[model samples]
Target: MEAVDLTAEQRAIIEADASDLAVSAGAGSGKTRVLVERYVQLLRECSIPQIAAITFTEAAAAEMRDRVRREVMSDPALEQHRALLDEAAIGTVHSLGLRLLREHPVEAGLDPAAAVLADDEAELLRRAACIEAIDAAAEVGGERTRALLGLGVYHAGLQLPRMVAQRDAVGAAFAAMGAYSADWPSYVRATLEAHYEPRQTAIRGQAEEIAWQIRRDAGNVTERLAEVAGAVLQPLTAAREAREWGDFAALLAEARSQTNLQSGGNAPAAVNVKGAMKELRELDDDAGKLPAWNEHDEPALEVLAGLRALFEDSVRRYEAAKQAQNALDYLDLELGAVDLLRDHPAVAAAVRGRFLHLMVDESQDINPVQAELIELIAGGNGDGARPALFLVGDARQSIYRFRGADVHRFPAQQALV
Candidate 1:
């Protein structure tokens, strides 16, 4: 790490000690180089096994490991640490979780010999579990069963497996929706206000300006065009002042439906008045397009609730099948690792004690579950006494949403740190 060639930001990143950091660097801005330099600095005080450097893929992990090795080999003082690189936790988060689970299989409540299932094997198991859950639910014959059937069994059959595959994310969404069940109206109203209120305010100001100009230039403007401007301005004013969305929408509708303002001469005042009216009409047209949020029966929520029940049942069956076969899927690795860390205090303390620094690359793609696992291992809120957690990723490059990646978690974790 030569100071002569490094930028100020890079120097800050490398020199900053102990405090948690979330660095967002764009492509080719030497993000990887900065991360490698930081890792090298950590190696001066921490053993390879004491730090965790997690990325997205095997190739990336290999590249990062190679960079660390090269940096270590370049300096004579780091000779003793070179051999420990192979045992370092530098790989995908899933691989790290797998390592944790294998180390504490008894505490994790899993068979010591359980192997990770192949993609094809996991998909087959998911499909089987979904079918079994659907059949069992249908056999029970209840309101939910009827609701599930009403959504079309064939459609449910096609969609339920996909949903089951991402059960953790879907389950979390369902929980959030249930939490807001009593406040949907407030949520809807707030959303509407945030979006339309500003535009309405701008329109009101613009229309008022146009109205004043028309009045001041009344001697130059025709009487017919003045009447048209008055007609449009009245509703526009009412729409802007209306407190309720319904009243505002109705006013916009009335304004947009007014007779068109036409210019009969080349006079500048007539042309200005006509053009102003036309522009006002277009703006009101946009305002009128606001969606009316009328309360009605939401059958989809009921069907989704029923599907949610089936999804849970499917998950239980999936776990049972995996346990019977003595195998674990990728999801199982993370969930198991989290369970192991959170449920057993001794295991958690040992893990926290083992890793003094945690660094995650491409952290923007981490979902809530993975974030929770990171927190559990990092010893909670990253406050005093917690090991430093380094997160570096650009939110724009988050492309793993299908595997439950939520880009919002990046900023949120940054704020917490």
Candidate 2:
């Protein structure tokens, strides 16, 4: 209603109706204000149900709905649309998904009355699935499964639940890693390259810096202190030249093993050496203990294979278990919606036609599945007519990696926009 107080950038975001946009602004920069302003503009051009504002949390969605209502009611020109505000698609992505799945349960192949499981209930179901999967694997007694059992049933039981929880990520990693039955050393080397190289680089620099300090500090002390300093420096230097990460880990292990380096006659010198050794100990703690996969480590690889197989079994059983109880987890909601959209083009087109503007907030925390769902609804200028997707997020504020949030997607979407 008024452009005098709004900045040029805010006006641009509010007025950009045709092109997709990815906006990045820090906290307290009025991101929510921009979203509301944009939604107001979209509301003027389309019906209420044709606009969707997807937020990160339920509280955020509620706040957004309230703010939009306030903006609409505050403007005399927008009074005619006041009654339809509650009918707008304003909620979290999961909420939108759940709504869509409920609308088209037959297309999604889901039970119409399935309940969404709470966190505690999902954990119980996941654990039960893992236990059943392990029991089945033990019964089959394949070679790899037997090797996994060799690691001890207790250990398998402990580790499988974690694997089940991170099933999607672990499955992608395993697929990238190729067959565990391949050459063990080569497999280990590849794994190190993919995951451990960054840590190795950081640890190498830290160890060398500490070694330099120890050498300088020990020189003014006794010859015994100097000898102990040499002992620390040897591995530090060797670790620097190490061709493999396992060798570097071995060097740190050697440094860690030397706990009783003492000289009785020179108490002050011994104390000085001990202090420097204390820093080395701290360094060892920071140095990630890389797995030492030797050439003959076929059993360990077999165990990994077994674990992967068990995770597969567990996921199948877990879905079945949820189905039996007529319950679906959050993952099921997002993925089920994606499947409905992908497999049913008519349904996807119907939903797409209804929502001409798709706005997503806190988009940095979206995982691949969520991204796929978003793309399926409003991908691009494919048919020359679709919803214009507006993604707003600050990658610097992305902290949900453990929950499978990929901050990289924010910038990737920026490039597309």
User: Which candidate wins on TM-score?
Assistant: 1
**Candidate 1: residue 43 Cα off by (Å):** 1.2
For each candidate in turn, the TM-score is 0.75, 0.71
* 377 Cα displacement, candidate 2 (Å): 2.1
Model 1 residue 224 distance off true place after TM-score fit, in angstroms? 7.4
Q: Write the per-residue lDDT of candidate 1 for residues 220-261, one digit (tens) a residue.
A: 767776676667668867765776766766776676566465
Which lDDT tens digits does candidate 2 get at residues 1-417?
467778899899889865789899988877888888899888777878888888978789999899889888999878878999878799988888998999997898878878998767988899999889877777888953674567677887777676666677777877876765565456666776778678778877777777676766666767766776777778777777887767887897687666457562455655666776777787677775655557657656776776777778888998899879989887778878999988888888888887888998988888787888888888832664568889899988887686677998778666656
* C-alpha local distance difference test of each model: 0.77, 0.78
Model 1 segments more than 4 A misplaced: 1-6, 118-120, 132-158, 172-297, 379-384
